[model samples]
Target: MTSPAVPRQPLLDDAIIALHAPTQAWSGRDGDIGDAAIDGIYHGDIRHIRSVRIRVADSSIETISRSIIDAATVEFGSVLRGLDDDGADPKVRLIRHRALSAGVMTEHLGLHSHRDVPLSVAVTVEVAPEFAPMQDVKAGLAATEPWHAEAIAASDGTPGRIEVRSSDGHRSFVVEAAGAAATVADTIVLRWDIELDPRSVVEIGWSATLTDDTLVVAAAANSEIAVPSTDDPRLARWVEQATRDLAALRLVLPDHPEDAFYAAGAPWFFTLFGRDSLWAARLALATDPGIAASTLRVLARLQGTKTDPATAEQPGKILHELRSAPLSLPNEGVHLPPLYYGTVDATPLWVCLLADARDAGMPEAEVRELVPALRAALTWITDFGSGTGSGFLDYVDETGHGLANQGWKDSGDSIQWRDGRLAEGPIALCEVQAYAYEAAVRGAQLLDDLGEGGGDELREWAAVLRDRFRDAFWVTTPEGRYPAIALDAHGAAVDSLTSNIGHLIGTGILDANEERACADLLLGASMSSGFGIRTLSLGAAGFWPLSYHGGSVWAHDTAVAVHGMLRSGLLAEAREVAGQLVDAAEGFAYRMPELHSGDSHDAVPFPTPYPASCRPQAWSAAAAIVCAEAYAAAP
Candidate 1:
């Protein structure tokens, strides 16, 4: 059997592959379509999709491919079969043709499952003359039955197979849509099972389908959520913008373990920051819990061990950020990140996550299994983490490429002296202690589930950490009082009263009064920037709204504050920060970026995206999960 010479495939039978109007919602939309946004990078080449259509028996299937990628040149079409895809009744269209522009990658775009018709799509491509693409990556290749047949390995009489590999050097997907044998320049076809499903989220998926020729091929599915009906034009536009942002946020997995995670955008942020990745995975959790689980596993596998010069990597340590690029180092030459580990707060936070997993009802055994890692993390604090040979956890990067202030805020002026002079390296930031305290407290819960000495050991660790932190970091002055942000290697206080000190409230390290005072400072006029709490007080000499960690408002950071407020029962204060942050996000398109500058509401004529920052950063994504809890708590 052979597939008929089909003439062109329409994206939708009658619908246009058009852009969202200026004022339109991306998701949860109403009947009306808004203005068109031309700036977007559709993965498929404009050359390929413009007036290109293939006739398929099923109307639900849609095929969009890109000539730019050497990986699977042929891609599957999503089937729009669910009630949500089409309106009340069916309106089909072999639709689409995107407006092209230069540097399209800068903006965001993705495949649209825009109809409710079912389809079985296949792709055919000619392999590079020299190499035979691997067919093993395809789903259900070489099988019988419509459900069973996806992609089958086939070779041209000349040479090679068809399989797609990612920029990170990892294979993506492969499938056979046609014949068992072929000649030079013969097409390698890959087919898909479903045309589209409204439930399709832009998550990883595999499917199979039968074609006209009984060809088997494996394929991957890419689906984006769209709002069906909406009243407000700006709201509609904002939703579409958000959906585009969601597509751009997809993380690029590397070919090998030692590679980096690169954001496919300007500032081209490419690193392996544990908190960031976990946070990003948190965003995708509702759509795919598997991603979150994989994130936990991957990060847990690399959990820090014994302080090394380059990273100061410690056992059971959750890394702050690991990179694989060459940057300006004090004396180092051009060296790629190759997994630079220079984070302090990642360790305790890792322990805290395990506790969260347990709280989220993860299995006791799964939680207990990571005890060795947790114990190692605790040991790290007493060992290499105490860079000053002091009991508290201090950070000193062995690598110049590594950050000096190794906690979340690794910027230079992030920590300061009481008089406002920036502190030097080998410092123990207060959040690490707070995170450690929280970890210990959470560890007690996890350990008690395991067996003997859990409660006693956890209690002992918490008590020591709590007492030492309270005494050592506490500060007092005639004007104001709060916990210190960090201590110099020599043990003098970097006495600047900043948000870092307030972070302690998040870890449950502060007493009731301390927590209340901390919450007050965050919401008080000195710190609250109307947009949200400034990273440091406005009165502080080192305060800089756009400063990386110095003053930028991180949604995740605020999320932590919200958690702290909730823990301390400061509902009003927490809601103040949480509500403002969410409302701020609503103004921006409902999509949160890595971080934003902390300026007064009127300071900027318009909100500015963080320069050289990663948009759709992982931690920023997870911040919403925590934020949702906070929003629901609002009363």
Candidate 2:
């Protein structure tokens, strides 16, 4: 006897096809099933179009092929059947071309009649605008609530034009149509009548423009950068995909229109993230130094000015995440203001980026101007970061609503001991200390070379911190001696062999012998899955292939480790890791996702994808660039 068969979910249902230009981005499902239920056109963190569907004579079209023409344009080929006058299967091909430019989207549709008889078809487009905040949309709460705006048909307008306005009259979207017999059937639908002769074609166009009551239009600027080429075909394709993904992720600030920085990722994290953007810009230094400069300036402008427990803001601290709307979860007692500053590592990472930008040959005057901000960041590291006077950087969420784990692995269960027990805060992460040390040493050099003083003070602090870290974090296990993941609240080493130690490479926090030991351990069978290094070793009690931070392989993390190995003169090890990353990229179509399962390479022919991983993530894209640059520079 056979059991009940479960319905197979459509892979394209959750697949993302996106196009963006500066502050404007449109993300949707691919193929003829482009449902706007969860997909929409977003302008500066606001959703404009919730649902858009095209039908011919009340018959839905089925997609045949789809392609991304460039960073800003997408083309889709679809066909409608059974629309003939004789009720026979029809051959009507529809070509849809969409492009985004300067906060406006233009869509062109081509309808061709392949049959011998003349065809008269009634085309209809249904659209709905939610005016929902991006955060609400990301949380999947927008569709359950009624739309915030009402669609108003434009009067005294040419042909087909409709406008939608919020109740407070603060935001509006204007949509215009051309080259077809069009009419506004109702508030949310438009009709176009097309007459095509035998073997004839007709084309129609539509444009949607978003406007605020303040009339603020973001200045348009291009973010395309040159990507390095390599002899390996797989590496070349990965670099090309990385370059395009980074270009599409660029977000221009409304106030500083001339400057551009990459948003974190698409779908959920398409906003300014302090740590994510800094790391991406740093990795892309070989490609474009301008990204590092612009990202540093933007983050400096938003640095914390005062202490506020409710939003986790503290003086001289960098922001963790920024949202366009206030986030409140009453049941969970969580309320995150738009500009929250709860990150423990971003402040130190900011100083490191400033120094990296200077090293990349930024103007001396510009680098000098940021010296004060760098000093303030260093001061935060000393005064606020080391709360226990232990000379180690640590963080604890003061507000019950803020994040529990404040490091890169911000999930609640991310920080744990070897016995699968959760560690107590204020937790000092192993990577955070390494980042702080690198920031200090590099920042001290910038201060001395840029005509600023007090380099010795930061150097002294870094020396002490490094000595303390080496003494407290290193542990001897039966298998081998490895660095602890972090220190718990009671000052006990939270000994778990994880990928966090991989970040210590190239940071100067590890000595030559220690670096070699880490490289060996990272490449060992318990830690490496042949695709990439796992977050946690397989022998650990908390190891699970699908766990977000425990056993998953993050593209960016692996890239960082490989770069460190290269810096440590472990060329063979670096190449081995890079080969696995390239193999994983092949499974992802050369567009790496945020992470994948840490399943053994021999267990499956292809890398297993994490269910909710964000594709085209900023740092993940930069990982490809980092690996390509490393290989090109290798002997």
Please identify model 1 stretches exceeding 4 Å from their true place.
1-267, 279-293, 305-307, 320-337, 452-455, 477-479, 602-606
- Going through the candidates in the order shown, the clash numbers are 67, 0
Candidate 2 Cα RMSD (Å): 3.9
Writing each residue's lDDT as its tens digit, candidate 2 over 273-337 gives 88998888887877878988888888888888888887777778899877756666443345677
Per lDDT, the best of the predicted structures is 2
Model 2 pairs whose backbones collide: none
**Tens digit of per-residue lDDT, candidate 1, span 1-635:** 99875322111111222221100011001111111111111221111111112223433333332221111111222333332333564333222222211111011112344444443333222221111111100111111111111233555542223343233332132322232232322222322233345423222121111011111111112324333234434334433444444333334233333222212222223334575555454433433343444446556667765556655565656765443323333322223254655677766766666666566566666666677876776666545567666778887766555666677776666787646688877888888888878877877776777873556776686788788877888777542788888888777777776777556775778878888887877887777666566777767777777787777777667767876776677777776786666655764555566677778766664445565344444455445554555555666
- How much lDDT does candidate 2 score? 0.78
Relative to the true structure, candidate 2 reaches a TM of 0.91
Error of 2 at 327 (Å): 2.5
Best by TM-score: 2
